[model samples]
Target: YTFGVGLITYLCSKEIYVMEHEYYSGLSIGIMAIVAVKKLGPVIAKWADGEIDKIEGEWKQGREAELKVLADAIEAEKKEQWRA
Candidate 1:
């Protein structure tokens, strides 16, 4: 998604340069690039962090549930052996 947006912006800037050289000046492009990066950087960071948190929560829950099941099975086996 980022790549696609960057490609389209590049193509658009090239077209703008061909149409009006002054509008595509270095300062203008640099400022625009900085603003876009600043705006997107925090959003991407928050999204990535959220996904990581969700995955970690799921892993912890899964491990606890698995351990509980194993412990129950062991207890049942021990009870059965004692009764025999």
Candidate 2:
């Protein structure tokens, strides 16, 4: 978008820049860049949090599954000894 604006500004330079001395164009571009950053801040933060949750959830699930398997094996071994 900034590149698009720059290209447009260059193309319209003879008319816009000639009248305003490029200050207006520069200010518009600066304002647009700041607005874009403000808008994307929350979305970026949410994306990071979602990624962290996915990674941590997988790790927790893997640990629980491992513990369950270990407990089941121990129970089975005890049953076999009791039968003996």
Candidate 3:
């Protein structure tokens, strides 16, 4: 959606300059760029937050599984030592 707006702005600006005498001033163009980035900032932040959540969840599950494996190995070792 943001890309579409930026593309349209760029195309329109080029067409206007070539076909007509109209031109976008540097300040106006800079403002448009800033607006686009600001508008998309929230969406990008949400995506990043979701990604971090998924990674943290996976890390937690992996740690639990590893701890269980270690516990089982230790129990087996203790039983073997007792039998010996």
lDDT of each: 0.90, 0.91, 0.88
State TM-scores per candidate.
Answer: 0.56, 0.52, 0.62
Question: In candidate 3, which residue pairs get closer than 3 Å at backbone N, Cα or C atoms, i.e. clash?
Answer: none
The TM-score-based order of candidates, best leading, equals: 3, 1, 2
Using lDDT as the measure, name the better of candidate 1 and candidate 2: 2
Clashes of each: 0, 0, 0
lDDT of 1 by residue, 29-50 (tens): 9998899889998999999999
Model 3, which residues run further than 4 Å from truth? 1-26
Prediction 2 global C-alpha lDDT: 0.91
Question: Which digits, one per residue and each the tens of the lDDT, describe model 3 over residues 1-71?
Answer: 99999988897787752533234576678899899889998999999999999999999999999999999
Worst 10 residues of 3 by lDDT: 16-25
Best by TM-score: 3
**In model 3, what is the error at residue 2, expressed in angstroms?**
37
RMSD of each: 10.5, 8.5, 10.9
Q: Name the 10 consecutive residues with the lowest summed lDDT in model 1.
A: 15-24
Per-residue lDDT value at 79 in model 3:
100
